[model samples]
Target chain A: MSNGQETSQETFAALEALKEHYSLPSLTFSVPRQVQGLVLPVVIAVVWEALAQTGILPANWLPAPSVVVATLLELLRGGELLGHIGVTLARVVSGFLIGALAATLLGGVTGSSPLVRRVLDPTLQALRSIPSMAWVPLFLLWLGIHESSKIALIAVGVFFPVYLNLLSGILTVDRKLLEVGQVFRLDRVQQVRRVILPAALPSYLVGLRSGLGLGWMFVVAAEIMGASRGLGFLMIDGQMTGRASVIIASIVLFALFGKLTDLVLERAAKGLLGQRGIEF
Target chain B: MGLAGAHRAALDIRGLCKDFAVHGGRVTALQDINLTVRQGDFISIIGSSGCGKSTLLRIIAGLETDYQGDAEFEGERINGPGLERGVVFQEHRLFPWLTVRENVAFGLGGGRENSRGESVREHIDLVGLTGFEQAYPHQLSGGMAQRAAIARALVNRPQVLLLDEPFGALDALTKIQMQEEVLRIWRAEGATMVLVTHDIDEAVFLGDRVVIMSNRPGTIKRIIPVDLPRPRDRGSYEFTHLRSAIYAEFFRQEDKPFAYAI
Candidate 1:
């Protein structure tokens, strides 16, 4: 081969070798970035374990890590932990579904038509400003102390974020794209279905993720009234008998499940909308 | 090619006047704009910045409907944007979410009416973007993106094609290349085309008749017809004559920064 051609071939081989070397270290570690996040939590756990063992704080008020783990394992063995998890999961899932569906439908309507917005937006905005927890007593009176009351509380919590985001998202779609729709002689219905919906999708996903987090937060407050089997009930029961370890165990489970469910939502959102440059 | 085809008006506008409400006062954008585009004609409207050339194209495309006087398409009163006239705007205006093939095929599936003529693939090939069908608008180069935009407008097989500064943002080399691509597509499709631009050479190179407009409250100042043969030589005497003839309309009033005397 000519000298220029030979050097080009050598350069190509060199680039291949460089890429392989660059990829090897990360491949061996397999998600080093994710593991790097664990360092802080592990440090906190070790500090807590050491402090409790040395009795720096009173043993009765703050239980040791060992006591919390032993109690959690005990609950798991009898299947009572599974039952508590199931009941809480059922409440959160149903409330989130009902809230998301109603908000999306109503928001779409009010976003497109000024008449609907004039009729409903003022009242909805008035409702949105009131703290969600204030409704707990009213819902207790209206829906009672059954699953219905708990689910209603969670549903109210989930609605506003989704509704507000969907309204703004649909309204903010690029006017230029809508002109393209107009040039093609698209009707209003086709414009919404094709152009408006896809353009607003990334914002809707943001609303969905935030609403998912708020749903978990309200489940605890919802179950505080007349609940006897959920994770919230376990927490209240431990507080009543002064078994701080049981209360702490339930709080730990809440934190873990909250993170786990949010992680699943983030992954699925990325899978659906990663190409459009939307991040959770 | 001459006054022979002028009698058969494809697009005819008479005593046209348009105004915009700007800063609580009326700003006249076009005044007494009269022009006739024949069937199978290639007409170019050339003017300076803020001269409302784009507004004229918009009116013809049915995107602007509040103008004074009559702007008719084939003797029908223009109402609003429709499928019969296809427009390629200054920017590519391709949806970032759509692939190249999908962007071109956007209007073909269903619009005002489903037109049956050339397929999407044929238009894509006409614009010289066959292999990059699956590429998104962001991934394509500027010229490639403009080509995709052209293909999208042509896929409709519209009775009239309207372009508003379609290649103004491209580099010099790419703009010339795209000018040739447009001429090729025009010959292949044989549709009436109206291009509005500020570049004098682009008007003379692409148009059978170059219509020069005066500045703000733009009006048809002059019309120069090209009598040269197919693929006219850019360096030849006749080509330079016609090019200078169009330039003379603007430079007729020298010692002024603007192209026309207000």
Candidate 2:
């Protein structure tokens, strides 16, 4: 055992020495990272310029990337894009918050108790099956063609996924862990806080990510239905005015926002659970 | 070590019978089982698979209350799980979301809020997991997680610690090490322990008396006293002899068809 330990120590030392000998320049940089971020957009702009110059497609149908950028810059300066974007973002955030909170609380209750699970399960399942768009007309009827209708649609869209995921996560908590809690005589609240809540978090986070994405989708769909403001309304307005550039710009912005939101969610999840190193 | 003047046994099993209704028919898991465990008794139950050793332990733990017989602790009938009887299952079953400290603290009772943090810390230290208190179950190795489970069970200071193949999932080296650790902890805590395992050698090593059971619809075949001193030598002639003797009894029960049939 002593000899084996010495050999392993020598092997580790050799590996470290090799790593130091062949070390490459560190890619770590403050400014270079920002430049790297611009690479994709710059490449796309160059490609668009080349295609427009070649006239491979009709100019009106496929406007140069510069033209789209100019249109976006003009819209921003006039406060049109900003106002719509702000409205759309506010709706999404409020709707998603309401849905996520309600789902989490209800999911926790149903997951811990069999009777509650039995009572609520079938109804939730029925509600979940109804498409988010299908609820737009009904919500409009109930709350009128207003912000409440859009928010309601988005909230319903977000609720089902979060609720199902959280409930399953709670239900699947290892019985052994519960036994451990029982042995200690942990009260119901402590058990929920210490065992049930934490155990259900990973699954809950997954649900949150998907729920937010769906919320974004439902918000756009709701805005398109009747709203006179927001990004989705802007797209519909652009369509009516035949401003292809504005339509394309709004779509691009929505995609970018979605990507950014996903990235932020991923980072948040990693920060919360990275140390524990839960694989799933 | 003395059984005298301890009132009645810490746990007493009388005419214990457990049956499970399977798809085929009613399968008897335990039949006419009787045992008495004095305070601080370390009893190991060993048998082949389906011999219902674990069923007996579960019954005593009050986890399985549907059994036909009675389990009494200090003259009171055993009911559902309580702080007095703690069970450690085969899997560690530590809550994945909870840190080691939190998991241990959970066993200290949720209603007793004021001093929980202190008690949880004490149990974590008792299990030698003081530094890893903030580490979640997913962060710990299998052996360490099992230790956390043990710590959780011990947090309630149960009168009896029932272990059902607690070390069965561990590697061989870890299993032996855990056996010793359990022996040391048992001595220190002076809690009555009932360990159920399929390994004869393990039963002989940890048990004051190894209880061998017959096959399905299980009943005790025999009780063999282990006279080895503390820190028992596994390689000693007496130890090996007793191990082989218990192994032989297990095989002998296997050879007899329906030895414990209803």
Candidate 3:
């Protein structure tokens, strides 16, 4: 709750399980590997800067990269941007926690039992087909235009993907592997812990990442509609005031935060799976 | 000592039948299988594909439960999987998520015999995979992975080691090397081994008695004793003769194609 580190690590662990299942290569910890990913963004910045300097594009529409950087720095010092980022991050993390935990539990139950899967799966699948965005208005009405509503909306949006992925993960585990568990004479509890959990990790992680991405999207929608103290509100305010630089700065901040969280997740996954002799 | 008593069978099966409900009616996977395995003896079960050799092994390991008639371990009626019997499949079946050492250690974790008996390192070294403890299943060659699986099974100190075609996936050279390794481990441990394979030479090379199985609705056709000495040469006439004897079961029916031609 205090920081994004633990939640991101959990997601990474799921991803690690997934990568291990697929036998995917993990990111090597190297300076070059780190530096390589940034090349494209740098190139885009150069192009943007060149176009701005030549005045080929209107300044208001496409502000100078330097101007955007200065605005970003100004916002950083004032502590205003951090406040918004903090608020948005808190919402995503909490919402993600609720969605992921519930989905994982439910998924485990349903995945292990054919009767439960038959009973619950169809209704959930029907609900999943209706995009999470459609639930925003209903959520707003049900919980009101407050933090609860917004967080609830994000949570609702996040639940299905993780639930579905986790379910599939459990369902699709190799029977042969389970047979191996049987030969070892693992008790039911040990079987779940040693065999089922590891085998289902990949799908669970895919669900988490999917849910996380959806949660972020819904948070933006929830904030834009009602909230006053989040990045989405900041963007909406920028639009209203015709402050393109502010808008662009907020966008860049969003992108940077998203990338940062994802990178942390990727690293966490590598560590968790790497320990198991899975590279990823 | 005064009076020597008769030794008990490591495994005893009588009228064991396994039938699977298929598309419509039930299909017999195994029929009227009667067998007895002596303590500390290596028995190889060789059969053509779909002969239910693997199914029979699974039944003995207590991985399969729906079979009829008697299947007992050391005179106790087998019901479920037990630590006293360790089974290794054709595939290494090492958990990809576990390292070579961790996979080997897994057998020690759960079971009635969870005495935490042997050192994991000792088993790994015993398999000659000392250096690759950190390696994953995907990183290992087929032979190495099989060794890891063997180590995992042996670590439990099971009274009977059930191997379902343990070397069926290897290249010819690696298979020979692994055959010898199995013999070394078999001698060292002196546990009862029942290895199921389609390879006739493998059966003759490793088994004290080669059990030949007939095709679908499988039943034991014959049991040929391989009276060869240690480290039996593949090129030797006696070894080849014993191997051919095991292979002969496949061609017992004259209308059937030659077993080797396929």
Candidate 4:
């Protein structure tokens, strides 16, 4: 019995030590605050350089990271890349904002009232089934190959996803929560603003993230169809001249911008939804 | 004025009927349910599941629109939900995005005439959530969340508070604590409250009058007046006697072998 007690004491001590060690969480090393912003591009540059130097492929087809940087700088100096970036950014932002705003308002109306949902559901369903690219020819016919056509293309791409998600989110809010609002004697407007809007936010943010990406993709496709400026135009222009560097540069810029936008949205979402009660 | 006000009942619910046209058939949830709730009275409705206790509370709160009912408050007919009636559901149902303070304020309305920021803060403190005003509902424990829900319901200073198994989701210890908290709040607020619960002990402990209900097209089986004092001892003879009586009634209904009768 004495030996058994001693062995159990030793086992208990070991268990305690194990628990302490497991409990003592180590501090994680965060990306350096200043250098954090530059890490992704820096890693890309290192990989690009390594691939180019290895000579696993032809040089003409695969430019070095330095070569791409120099070409980007040259394009900036020539006032071409900056202008294209500006045009593309402006078109995407405006079109996405318009589509998102309209979809949100319509979604709210449809979500709250079954009558409105029934009226709008079939038509919206049919429209959503048609691809955004399918609208390009018709949009071009109506608006011509101008900024309007590009905006229309991006807006069409963004509309369905944002509306559907927002509507569903609003519809699925806990009925019990709404009853709380009623008990308080909250007016109709107050119910929507205070309860429905906040309840639908996480889903709305998701819709925004997806809608923005779709809008960007549609804009590039529209630009490729025929535009004098923007990233897609730069790629088309490069393809016409057999200049692979410009096409590759444009692709890189698209990726960089998309990543930046997503990062900003993710940061905002974390700030808004990270609180204890809020569900993502 | 207090005694006179207590004599004058806050709510008089008569001939309350509610039915649903479910896929199976017409289901009668409540039938000819009549009840009177005095000002500052604590009443508990005890019944089996599907006994329509919740439906009755919802009708009083005006959350159920399709009910045929004559529910009046202060001698006035209640057509819809007003600021005079408040409800706490089984689930806390606190809004996810808002902090405890904001969730409480949501019922206060956005009008200029309505009390604003500081008054909202006062109500939060009253519910014993002084430090947790900024905490979200999900961050709170089940009991705390229910407390927050009660706080939210009481923020409007409604005359009638309807609780539909508010502490049903809590653990035993937490439920006991919450029941004490609710009783304290109800006394402090001097609000007429109708609580629906399955626990016989709970119904006996907190209620001034326990209304036992029969199942399916539910009607009041009996209304047992609890003559016990405030903060009544759970282990006392009266408490056990009342609890056993309610339990006996519940089982009596359950054990009826009607189909086997010749």
In TM-score terms, which candidate is top? 2
True contacts kept of 3: 0.63
Residues A35-73 of candidate 2 have per-residue lDDT tens digits of 888877888889888898799756677778888889999
Off by over 4 Å in 2: A1-49, A186-194, B1-3, B111-122, B256-262
Each prediction's TM-score versus the true structure? 0.85, 0.86, 0.85, 0.85
Cα lDDT of candidate 4 equals 0.84
B48-81 in candidate 2: lDDT tens per residue?
8888998888777777788788888878887767
Off by over 4 Å in 3: A1-43, A53-55, A77-79, A112-120, A276-280, B1-6, B110-121, B131-135, B252-262
lDDT of 2 at A177: 65
TM-score of chain A, cand. 3: 0.83
Residues B65-178, model 3: lDDT tens digits: 888999999889888899899888998888888878788888777442332345688888889998898787877778899999999998878989999999888879999999
Q: Which regions of candidate 1 are displaced past 4 Å?
A: A1-31, A57-68, A275-280, B1-7, B110-118, B228-262
Q: Model 4: what TM-score?
A: 0.85
Better of 2 and 3 by DockQ: 3
Computed on C-alpha atoms, the DockQ of candidate 1 is 0.32
* Cα displacement (Å) at residue B140, model 1: 3.1
Taken over the whole model, the C-alpha lDDT of each candidate is 0.86, 0.83, 0.84, 0.84
True contacts kept of each: 0.46, 0.51, 0.63, 0.73
Q: Rank candidates, DockQ, best first.
A: 4, 3, 1, 2
